[model samples]
Target: MRCQPPSTFQVYIWLKSKQSCLLCDETTDATFPICTGCETDLPWLGDQCERCALPMPMAGLTCGQCLRHPPAFSEVVVPWRYDFPIDSLVTRFKHQGKWPMGRLLAELLGQSLHYRFAEGLPRPDCLLPVPLARKRLRQRGYNQAAMLARWLGTHVNIPTDERLLLRVLETPAQQGLDAKARKQNLRKAFALADGARIKDRHFAVVDDVLTTGATAHALARLLMDAGACRVDVYCLARTPKPED
Candidate 1:
């Protein structure tokens, strides 16, 4: 099933319930499948670099680095580039407490997952969002990644173990870190929340974006070490790597 687009249908329903569109505020009648307006605006990594899902000029599957050294996870699925309304939406959700948009993004994700992962895709045994640090979670009032996972699970019928991954250390943000620096900076940054809960399970790790993939890689590393049979990264967006 190709996932449906982000429906204006959800926005309409939500506005009808609240008597106004509050920008992801109302949880009542908040659950939805897909929306209308989001059909085309949700961009996809069409014929991208298989390793990172970065859009490539050529049609080859593997990028050089991925051929030389494979990543920790089985595959990477990215629906859109991290820019424009999405970048703004993410900023609002993460910084201004605009939570409903997270569901909106999830709608787009479900659709993209269908197109990207293929039909009859087996849902992971469980879904997880990369855990936020205790301080960050407290300060932000919510974890955007967890919210995304929740809505994604609701749409696709997968159980989301929201707490399966734990941030064991609080490291500097990866905003400016190079890929190599990112891996090093994230050493011991994460762990299985309770290894017992995740043992022998396949986990689909969800996040808002993939930028150097440092965090995703590190989290995937710990997930496998903690007994996850496989880890597939699902992100709303993937940023292009910087050119030298």
Candidate 2:
């Protein structure tokens, strides 16, 4: 006699026994570290701008700022809003050099991009992790964006080109700066590596968080100037604009 397939309940029990929630340490039947409950509790972005992924009042509507001044990138793919536990987690991962936290976040973001691709989002030709300044890389010991990009690229089967974009300037930290100041700070900050070839290519810049989008804009402009036909931003989180 042929063996029968396992029931859904059996699979669920198996998963629950094998995995535990990252946030609460509860037994879970999910693949990722965070359980379904904690994932639902995440600051997931909803009804966001099609161009920039900024949270908006309604879905499929462009934000007023993008309408007024278009961004350099064609579109942004962000999985979460920068808030609460996510902010805390990103801080610990990015600043504290917590590799486990960074890996978990990148895995979740990769899953989000996979779903988006299933839902008709076009996969870019390549992924470019926004380069960190030499000074910052030396200080941090690793580039957080590069790590995220490698993880995401491996999961999604996209080529990650870390050498295409170069950070030529070591600017001050972007925290506490207004949009104008941020833009000014990023000006002349990025450059293309010598002998890089990107004509007619579509690329996505991967990062951990997008606040003010100054860095994305600067990098996208550099890529375009270097013959990239389309540039997109793929970030784990997008922060809302601060009120005046």
Candidate 3:
């Protein structure tokens, strides 16, 4: 038989355009690897809530809220909590649409996921980025979650199916909304895109951050309603519990 083709993974990491790896600007060629400093920062989720993946006192496996009523998605794998430098990174990337940081954040999420799923977390069948409102997409010119989803799909060898879902109802942004308001605003806010033949898929939902999870929870419920077997959330950061 004629020599077979290079697989998609091989084609994926193959440097196109001599690109600079995010976070550390290093030229790519045949020999040198991507920046290890960025690699280390990306590979592990330090001291987090086992259930929600919020960086918390490792003393407890689950937070009080999670203990009271667990969420729908399986264990969330988050590299950092929403604080310190991460809040700045997320704000710049999401609100300001700093596109490059999306790659850096995705690289970390992918690496952290590699450590988790490689050791065997049962990788999902497809990656669905948290959908953006059409209005927001128009204003920002891109969905940073979608950007992160692309990197993750390449790194982990899953298809990034952006068209699998849609944010049909444009709700008020979640930032200023209180917990009850957040839930109400996000309810009925999303739906599976028409003609999406997604039956029996296990999806990993990628996003920049997980705040109260009202948005993600709504999305997960939608996916489940549309026949997704399960959902796993992969996010760059998970917000710490709001102090009383």
lDDT of each: 0.74, 0.88, 0.77
**Model 2: lDDT of residue 31:** 75
RMSD of each: 8.4, 7.6, 6.0
Q: Which regions of candidate 1 are displaced past 4 Å?
A: 1-38, 116-120
Report the lDDT tens digits of candidate 3 across residue range 30-139: 22234655454543446776767766656357776778777777778787767655677678888787766766677757776888776889899999999889998999
Give all TM-scores, in the order shown: 0.80, 0.90, 0.81
Ranking by TM-score: 2, 3, 1
TM-score of 3: 0.81
Q: Which residues of candidate 2, in runs, are more than 4 Å off? A: 1-17
Quote the positional error of residue 31 for candidate 2 in Å: 1.0
Across 83-167, the per-residue lDDT of candidate 1 in tens digits comes to: 6767877778778987776777787688667664576545688888988888888888888899898888887778888766778
Backbone clashes per model, in order?
A: 7, 0, 0
Clashing pairs in 2: none
Put down candidate 2 lDDT per residue, 1-244, tens digits, no spaces: 7487656435333423457776789887777777888999999999898999888888989988889989889999988999978898888989998887788889998998899899988899999998988998999999999999999999899999999898888899899999999999988988888988888899999999998888999888888877889999998899987871
